[model samples]
Target: MRKSEPGRGLSVPRTGWRARIADRPARILLLGYLFYAAVGWGLLMLPVAQSGPVAPLDALFIATSAVSTTGLVTVDPGSSFTFFGEIVILALIQLGGLGYMTIGSVALLVVQHRISRRREAAARAAFELPSPVSIGAFLRAVFLFTFLVEAAGAAILYPMFLRAGVESPLWAAIFHSVSAFCTAGFSLFATSLEGYVAHPGVSLTVAALSILGAMGFLIAVDIWRTLLRRRVSFGFTTRIIVSVTLALIGAGTVLLALFEPTVAVLPWDARLLAAFFQAMTAATTVGFNTVPIGNLAVPSIMVLLVLMVVGASPAGTGGGIKTTAFATLFALVRCTLRGRRDVLLFGHRVPAEKMRTATATFAYYIGFLVVASGLLAATEAGAAFEHILFEAVSAMSTVGLSMGLTGALSEPGKILVIVLMTAGRLGILTFGIAIARTRPDDTAAPQPFGP
Candidate 1:
């Protein structure tokens, strides 16, 4: 006899696709993407969304990658997506990178009304916003930040592109503007930024855009506000972020330069520029590699591995433990060394709960990458562990760098990478909460113990 789930339907089982999607987070951003994905899927089915109508799986993949801001694409983005499709993809990337809640708040404020509490709360939790804000204030800051950065980035890049003589200056500017602002790091060309290895105009501009995007708007606002005040003082969080970011950039650049001996041959200034650019991009989790990464020595690759694991700032575009978590964790270590009772930074003591969250986040990140690498080795047969780790790190960080192995991956490998990209973009912690199985009743037995 066949059994069915509780109350779905006669024809369709209770454990349907719809049921699975329902229990996910209250983050409206995720749901909004699903809605767009369905629409994009339907669009693909139409004769116009594609050259000959893309397969459902490909459409869903494109939609997920764009909306999630994960640049792992099986189909060539330039050839398959038309102007309309490209617009849709860009819109999804911008909205996804900035969280739909952000866009909603911006819209509400544009019309001169308050944002709903639900949206503000979701946005707050995602970005760890410190204060309760009326939607208009929050919206103004977000739109302002986005426009200023993207516009500045485009202005810097347009002349460079004109000099390079790319076919469509307008299209190139727009594509890059969206890519940089979203921290998507996705390029229309197949080679990514490989051709721009020595072009500081291209590299520096992209790196700046990525760094700004990954810092998240709140941090940007904080830094900007502080700068505007012309004060030497900083808030606790801002101090932590600034200090950690500078340290990471310095350390990461040194390591990258030391590891890549070939880069050592370049003029000191040029090498310094490349190292700084690469470090900034990696730290921000924007995987635009100006230099050919696959040829890097193992030591250089290791440096990149650490940077990928560390990841970027909170809530902006990049992924990983975030600069704050790293700072908090580092403080915890320092506190232990100095034998202090609390993990303090910038004269502020971090809460115990935040420590737990940071530790858990780091554990989840490392565990996911290790397991993913092991599985890739099993399925990929002849592939080395280095390549596997590279693939895994690239996926989990949503960094699009590859070892010339992306095209060689089998179907199963592609599936694994896709899962990693989605997980990385949505966040491992977020997924854990969603699929977590437990209740208050499931707690361990309470036995009285005398120690």
Candidate 2:
């Protein structure tokens, strides 16, 4: 028996954590967040990163929010973070917004001056593009489009910032432009866009940037190509995205105007601007509120809730279930009701695989929303259900529009929110995949390709 026991060490080991992490794309994405969050937390903890010592939890919280681009901050970026720290936050926003994959590809392109097969595959996976397009071309389009829009937005905002006599107008304009286009919602002003609530130029510029970002880079590329080529045709996905976005904006504005007496009581110009800003903010998931979010009527908040949950389109800076997914689910239901064999939208059949994914995504979103809200409600005893629900939805959608409950959340509540925000940004499917225990390869052996 002793001699037989001696051979135990000769057997091969099972799969390791490294293999699991390396094999799953979702795990790579999750690990990327942890790495970035750790770096950000360390940077933010530095004395130069802040005017005073920040609690470790607060530093970690801010780092997580910034890296997720969730914008659900316990501490104000403008006051809590020093200039160096603000820059760090801005850098995190950009990194989170543009996505690490895209940024890595760009850096690779710069350093290597050639795209490797592995790099191309990584970019393709990160972007989740269905059809293969040249990775270099796609990266270039995204990079150029982003900078151009942000630059234009900054130019539009500079005069307004200067007119308002904001200290460091240039910096304010630059920061806001990046924040808006990235849909990060990190404002320099303690009151957010409240100071510019009545200023059409400022509100409009911010709204424009948010909308453009939320439209998704694919739609942007389509629009650009259409204009450049002088063609009117666009893809079905692009049509659905644009149509839903504009419709949400219009419906949200009208609903807010009707429901919120506070907004209705403003002067005609101010009233229109306020409604538009709020609508755009919700629809785009930009999270900048010109008016006091806590003062919003229940009905108006409901409208914003729906908008936030629907969120922006796929591949955009914003988060939530996404516009296309929502639309596809609607189409699927309509087809079932009509006894049709296939889901049709804009005269094209929606693929069954896409429809299934949409349905699954919707289910996952609702599941997360309910679970997060329940956890928050249990932890935050004194908070109203409505406020807790709003906070939960906002955090889960990465919309960041709070009903004044964010700053008052208990430690448990904050942890719940952090989880929701991470899930929202990483996406439900990706997060699920990362956490799922069943590894596909381990379930069964692979068969021949032809079979």
Candidate 3:
């Protein structure tokens, strides 16, 4: 080897994964999730993590689902996994829901009392926070809010679980509480929330936690600022997210209540409650269903499909195209219909960047849904086209509702869904960007478009 130049250290140039993702937050997030999923898969594959031998693919599927907080299960988690495995899944859910960077940042804050600029950039990208919001404040609020809500939810659920004759009521309550709040929808019960259809206390409590989690941390921060800190008013994004969420929930509830045959057969009080629970679950992308989703009529299915596509708000535990993006699409249409150029919502003009992002998100979602659905249709030749489409949407949206198709998926189908869940958890645009090639001169001024 050549001798080093005078005053030149022997440090070799940084190369490989670290250098590649150094400045790329999207790549960092994407790989971070993959790393966690891989670790979770390995841990879950051990003998101690399983009650019985689990197929490798199924273990990987469950691990991915937990890390994505998507809640789709190839096996009944309760029966297939032992206590240790369940804890592993729960840990994955918490990590997934909180996000890899978020947890890392919090830990750093606790230990070092300061976050590095690079880590701060990653956290900002992960959350897509507004310029006015400080990353430190937001992360602290997120941690506190998550634990408080989860604790309260568990407390409320403990007595309900005990009354319902559940085995290990305390553990069941705690597990389900975290699951709901994370909007992970992983249930210890074999039939999800179906057994609690008539239990308004449980249904509503779980629904409340899911809603709170899915509403996005920005909303919580906004509320804290407005109500507690005496800030001037709620942020525009918060207002829109709340409005769209409530509207979707309300619309889904009414449509399902009116058209769902299963809900129609229930007693009047339980019928409305079930419909509301199903609607809220779908809208929040929480995946818990009080009624059997498989037996629902076409109209009810359609309603759920819409809700899943719209999904929860941005910077939230849940996933989808997102409420703001969906709202922006509607605003664009309204403006275009009136022969105007400015996209306006709730008296505020939408920024051009936001409009473009919304349009791209909508296009990507539709494109991915169609492609995945067609592939599923081809792979599962005997399965109904409707079910294939539903599964595709559900997987891509990270809304785990299935029409009795999940357990019976072919190997290829399972793999496809795994990809979808990963993509869904990593926002579609972020996933696309992470995989796409980039130029060193990306900061150069934009050039005119050409056909």
Candidate scoring better on TM-score of 1 and 2: 2
lDDT of each: 0.73, 0.83, 0.90
Best by lDDT: 3
User: Residue-wise lDDT of candidate 3 within 150-240, one digit each (tens)?
Assistant: 9999999999999989999999999999999888999999999899999989999999999998888998788778887676578899999
Q: List the residue pairs that clash in candidate 3.
A: none
Error of 3 at 65 (Å): 0.4
lDDT string for model 1 (178-204, tens) is: 787777777876677777777878888
Backbone clashes for every candidate come to: 0, 0, 0
Q: Residue 172, candidate 2: how far off, in angstroms?
A: 0.4
Candidates in order, TM-scores: namely: 0.86, 0.92, 0.95
lDDT of prediction 2: 0.83
lDDT of 2 by residue, 323-400 (tens): 888888888889899999989987789988988888888898888778888888899999999999999888877887
- For model 1, what is the error of residue 420's alpha carbon versus the real structure, in angstroms, after optimal superposition? 1.8
Better of 2 and 3 by TM-score: 3
RMSD in order of candidates? 6.1, 5.7, 3.1
